[model samples]
Structures are given as structure tokens and as C-alpha cells.
Target: MLITQCQQADVALLEEHLPSPSRTSFHAQRFARQGVGTSTYLVAWLADRPVANAEIRWNGCAATEVRQAVPNCPEINGLSVTEPLRGGGIGTALIRHAERLAVERGVQRIGLGVDDDGNPRAAALYARLGYRPVVRYLDRWSYTAHDGEVHDIEDPCVFLAKELTSAPTPDLGVRVQ
Candidate 1:
């Protein structure tokens, strides 16, 4: 297994695993354009093939509800392990990598949202990684299911957060157990 920063060539590979909003080509382009700002993207490769992905970002107004609760918390924007690789520990590995990235970037905390259905295992995985529920914002809206919807829209988006140590680069001291 190898963890690598994404390049232009891997844009499509990143897209395949993103939620619908990121399926289009330019989404990768835009994310790449950010080049490690409040948000950045990463790909987890297994034996030369992209098998998992994660996104790390600074908490901002776009995350108004999240910010209101955990002010200035850095966010784990997104993460996913391909279906075939789901139970092989790839997601956990990717998330741990993101935690390291957050610590390296001087971020003192992390946040993310998951669906209410409990179908997406990221919530459970993050829980194991020291993330705890900080806030839960209800989205009183609905949407049609299409081929490329990116963010979660499970009526109410459940927000989770974790406090991170900012002193060291590559710190994985975060523990949920």
C-alpha cells in the first residue's frame, strides 16, 4: 500500500470514488486548483491502483453550522474506499493518513458529516479514529437522485469532530479507544 498526493493524471481516478458532486471532470480540476488551502484531496493507492481517497480542509463559512459549533476546526471533507476494498482496512488507513495531514498543516481539530441511515461506514470508522459527534444539523430539503450528487443529503447531516494536536507534523496520536 502506498499513500500519494494526487496529480492531474489521477483526477479521473479520484472522481470515480467521490460522491456525485465530484463526478464531473472539473470538480477534480477545481479541487486541484486549491492546492492545499482550506481543503485538499488525497488518494490511497494499493499496489499501483487507486483504492481509496480522503479530503482534508479548513472549516469555513460553507460549513456554517459546523463552524458555529467547532470554531476553527479543520475538516475531513470526505473519504471513501472503493466497494471492493471496503472491509480490507483501506478506509481506516486513508483516514489515519488524513489525520497526519491535519496535524502537519497545524490544524488543531477535524470535522466531517455522514448520512443518518448508517449506510456509509465513514461515521463508524471515524468514531474508531477519535472523532465524536459535535453537532447535527437538520437539512429540511429534498433532492432527486441522479448520477453525480456529491455531498450528503440525508435530510439532516450529522456533523462529527475530533480535536487534533497541532504541535507536530505527521502526528497520529489521536485515539478513540
Candidate 2:
């Protein structure tokens, strides 16, 4: 599999691989953000097809608390692998690649927000990757659907961050659970 930061031309691949009715333009938006240098849209391609995707937001997560807790850390966001392709190391590779990219950009730390109440497996993965909890926050955000209808989401979450260069973060709370 080949992982590459997506350009404007790759939005079609992201949508083609993860077809979602309500998520139209999501890929385009990510590409646009990449265009402006605020983020990077990374796509994992296997056999000439996109198999997984994630975005690295240089400014951290949308949650105010998360951003405040881990300022200047690039937050890995929107990581997803097709349901049929889960547990195949695709997601893991994508994350590692993201971390490497951050390191290349002179970033010393990286972060990601895991849905605390709904995703234990992800939390476990982050722990194994050396990310520790830094802050627990409500992930409050919104997006516009393809129909232009705004949708809001509120999920209980914890911000996990890892050092890329031996620059440790002071422990903020309990282990991922």
C-alpha cells in the first residue's frame, strides 16, 4: 500500500473509496484545507485504490479544551478505514505515516481525540502507540451535509498525545479506558 498526502486531484479517490451520502464534499473540504496549508489529507492507496484516509490538522482538534491542552501539536483527525478492511494494519500504517509527516515538518508532538464513550479499541491502539491522555473534553462540532443542512455532534472524548522526539508531556489524567 502507498500512503500519500492528498492533493486537490485526489478528492475523487477519497469519495470513491468511502462513499457516504451525507458526507458529500467532505473530501473536497479536506483537500481545500490542504491547499491552504492548515492541514494535510492523507490517503492510503492499495492496488490503485484508496483504502483508508486521515487528516492531520496542524492546530489540533476542534474541541476548545483539546486545542488548549495540546497547542501546536498536529492532531490526527478523521481516520477511517472501510468496514470490510478493518484490522488489517491499514489504519495503523496510516497513523504511523502521519506521525512521520509531522516529524518531517519539525513538529515535536502529535495528538488525536478518541471518542471516550464509544471507542475502546481506538483508545487501546493509541495507548499502545505511546499516546497518553492529556485532557478529557466534549467533542462539539458541526458540518454541512450535501444538502447544505448543518448537523451537530457531541461526543465524550479524551485527547491523547505522543512525543515524536522524546519531549514528554506532563501526565494529565488516567489511562485510556
lDDT by residue (1-177, candidate 2, tens digit) is: 777878667787777778655655788888888889899988887767888899999867877787788887789998998888888777778778778778778898899989987988888888987899999999887876788898898888889999896333322321111
Top candidate on TM-score is 2
Relative to the true structure, how large is the alpha-carbon lDDT of every model?
0.64, 0.80
Deviation of model 1 at 30, angstroms: 5.5
Q: Which regions of candidate 1 deviate over 4 angstroms? A: 15-23, 26-30, 138-155, 166-177
Give the number of colliding residue pairs in candidate 1.
Answer: 6
Q: Which stretches of candidate 2 lie over 4 Å from their true place?
A: 21-24, 146-149, 166-177
Residue by residue across 10-31, what tens digits does model 1's lDDT show? 7765556444443345437536
